[model samples]
Target: MHTTTSDTAPEQRTAAPRHPVARAGRISAQGAAALVLVLLLLVVVRLPWAGDLGMHAATVERLRHGLLHPGNPLIDADTPSPYYSPWTLLLGIVAKLTGLSVFVVLRLGALAGLALLVTGVHRYVRTLTAHRAAPALALLSLLFLWGPALFSWSGFLGLNSLALTVSYPSVCALGLTFHFWAWLTRAARGPIGWGAGAGLGVLWAVILLCHQFTGVVATLGGLAMVAGARPARATLLRLGTGLLPGLLVLWLWPYYDFFALFSAGGDLEAVHRSLYRDLAGRFGYVLLGVVALGFRLRRDRRDPLALFFALGVLMVAAGGLTGHYSWGRALPAALIPAQLAAALQAVSAGRWALRRGWACVLLVALVAGAWTQAGTLGYVVRRDALPGAVAAKYREPWAGYQWIVRAGVRYGDVVMARRFPARQIPAYGPYTVAPGYPDVFLPDADRREAAMKRYFEAGTGDGERRAILRAYGARWVVGGAPAPWLHKTAVGPRGQVLYRVAP
Candidate 1:
């Protein structure tokens, strides 16, 4: 009897190793964030949206009038340049065929890409979240999206900021980033894993043609991870093989460096003073939060993949600090992992708060605040933030040109305008313009300005507009609300205006 107590076996405990799917799938941070993403997406779907409207005006002007792009010649020719992507041109072609507004095409395309981005982000967070996070994760996902992707191209500074924005044929490179990072972290499954990588390579190539900045940043991100392990050549080859097609597409502009293209210039210091300040200021916070997070997740952070979330956050902070503090370019690339982590933490915190009582209120408050902010941001971007008009116009500039061609004028007649690009004439309609400024397509800015200016001045006379008409073969003069230069003929409701010259 006495021996029985001493010899008694301590309770036998066994745990089946958690299946990743079961772990990730069973209610996670990602699910919480994804819920918000879906909600925001639904709102983004319906809209009379516009952003970067002027760019579309410019692009459509060229396409509708068949004017060549004065700046870059590669787009005008069938042989694409590595610097110039065929995607926008193809979009223009499709818009012409479909009779959709160039803005419409672009806005719709961006919207679609955004939807996918949210889904991908949700998955990204799910891949990274360490435990069952459905409820909290769903909320966190919503919060993170509003701050990053949803607002990437919206508000004061966001993604799709036309200046830093890039696109390929039908995709926005940034939109697919979640999936790109997600795959690297996911336990590589069969064809699905391979497929994701292959697909990413294709999308990344398109990203280069569309928005080289984000693409470069993303590459930097992935490269940082790759350098750590110095993985086998086979893995590298797989990534390269999948990328070959896009690489060939990108090589279209061989003149742009295959290397040094992404390097910060020598004056990285002065070129972006504000960015540096912002980045430096945020560095403390970024380091504090991300590194602390690295520790918080240390028990589960055994995998190489975890570094991505932390690294992504830090890199974004770096971008904000170094570049012009462009939210699209600097923030999202790094915030990506942070966002994913936040969602998981929120959910984890939520469950803890529920169990722990009032002391957890502060923790839960942070979670709630973060989630609400994300949802609110998403709602804002979806409802009003994105210059949908601006984005569409930038994506397709043919709309701007259609006004010029539709003028009740004869063929072979020219239009007088200011700062109108001359290259898109061929794509737009049977029209021609003089003084191809910014004719990088031909040579350099000097050549472009010289040629365009000569053509512009030839037809104008102070005493008589007729002399100018005769010189440039102009049959009509046109202008729009956005173009204040044209006096006599201003654009109407249809976005066109025409002035009669000497017959």
Candidate 2:
């Protein structure tokens, strides 16, 4: 029988490897539980969409149609907008391919980005240490960090803000940058290839497309990675060459205008002030966590984790001073991965350095963290549970603007409104307000603001109104209270009236 089995042939002695799905199905209960925990965390962490989220959705929706590219829908519809990022382009493509509404696509896409970011951070932490608790601790640091989960002046709290509060482009950019760094870190340990170098360049370019500010942060982190590795000239050359595509994209698209806006004194001081205010309560905890982790890492200069965190902090500081609000806002996205690695190491070291009884207390603290996280998630969902809660919060009195869109206000029509800003209305209607808030940088912004002021004056006579309207070229007025001078064209769904300017 043994002879017969040997005669069967060498090939028959070994069975083909099981399909990945079959292997995956054989995962232990612990692995399965971990998977469930991750999935739950994804849902809990992603907050409801609001404000800029809606605007971004509307931008993508427009792009999906004949609009082709992104524009400030609330501003001059014809003029290019800074919203023309790789994220919007990808959202449009996904919507088209899946036949899903851009709104739905945006939500799902953001969720996917969140998932990618968490997984990338988890993998990176594991790479830093063999301690089993380190990975979970990393996640706990993120979940338990004292940050705004709903809305901040910059967006949402912590790293979640990038994916949820801010534009999806930033979220995707964060995820891409994290994955790229993770890959770069691994490749640095081995002999790198031309393919990886090219890939890094291409990835860098894509990050630029997603968000120029994020691109800057990625460059900083990537340089830190390279410095740590001290890679050969060929690798560095390839990385440099890879940036060409991104630079070309910047030249060809909205970045040219984006830089111009920032350079032209784009109310940067105000943005900087706002960013500082947001950072006050939110970032301090993250900094402390990173510091704790850094101390545990032996403060090694060559450590990639330390370098990455340091570079991230430097980039954030530079961004703040330079009036790069998005850069400053998105800096956390880059730092979170490193912060997690540090946290894991720090926590693991603490467990080892302490007595067994103290270890039990650490376990208790982790369980408490899990419980608190669940409660926090519950509070977040409950607070914004009502239908249109976010819309009511941000859109405010302009929640009725959709009626104007339904009433078929001319596309790109410039209307004067007291409540909703021009940019905010674009999410609900095809029309633009005369001169809304100074959110987006527009050419002739000073003149528009002045004209808007005159139009809203209590003593503004018909002649003055006409002159103001003529100056701003706005034909319609969306107001709450009826005006004797205005000829009512149509009543909106919410009983708000649209009036034609009587010359």
Model 1 agreement with the true structure over 1-503: per-residue lDDT tens digits: 10111111111011212546435544443465455445444534432223333343335434433423323221222221223344455555666678786556655555655655556655554544433443344334333233212222421112223112222222355555556655543412112245555766776666666556556546655664444324445555566566776676666644343444444343333433444443433322223234334644564443333555545556656656555343334454454444444434333433343323421332353343443233333333443444544333223222335454554544344555444434333223323344332222333334334433553464544444445446546555554222222345435445545555545
Candidates' lDDT values, in order? 0.42, 0.55
Residue 436 in candidate 2, Cα distance off native in Å: 5.2
Per-residue C-alpha lDDT of model 2 across residues 1-503, encoded as one tens digit per residue: 11111211222232212445323322432253365345444543443444465467656766665446545546564566666666777777787778886557766776776666667655555445544445555655554443332323322224333323433676667667767776765555445666776677777777776766666767776776666655556655665666665566556664236455455455645545565565544444455546544653475556555676777777667767776654565555444644465344333433333423433443344343333233333323444553453324332212435566666566666778763445455655354544344545567666666677667777777677777766666767876345666788888655667887666
Report RMSD (Å) for each prediction in the order shown.
10.5, 9.3
Cα misplacement distance, residue 250 of candidate 2 (Å)? 3.3
lDDT score for residue 86 of model 1: 40
| TM-score per candidate | 0.56, 0.74
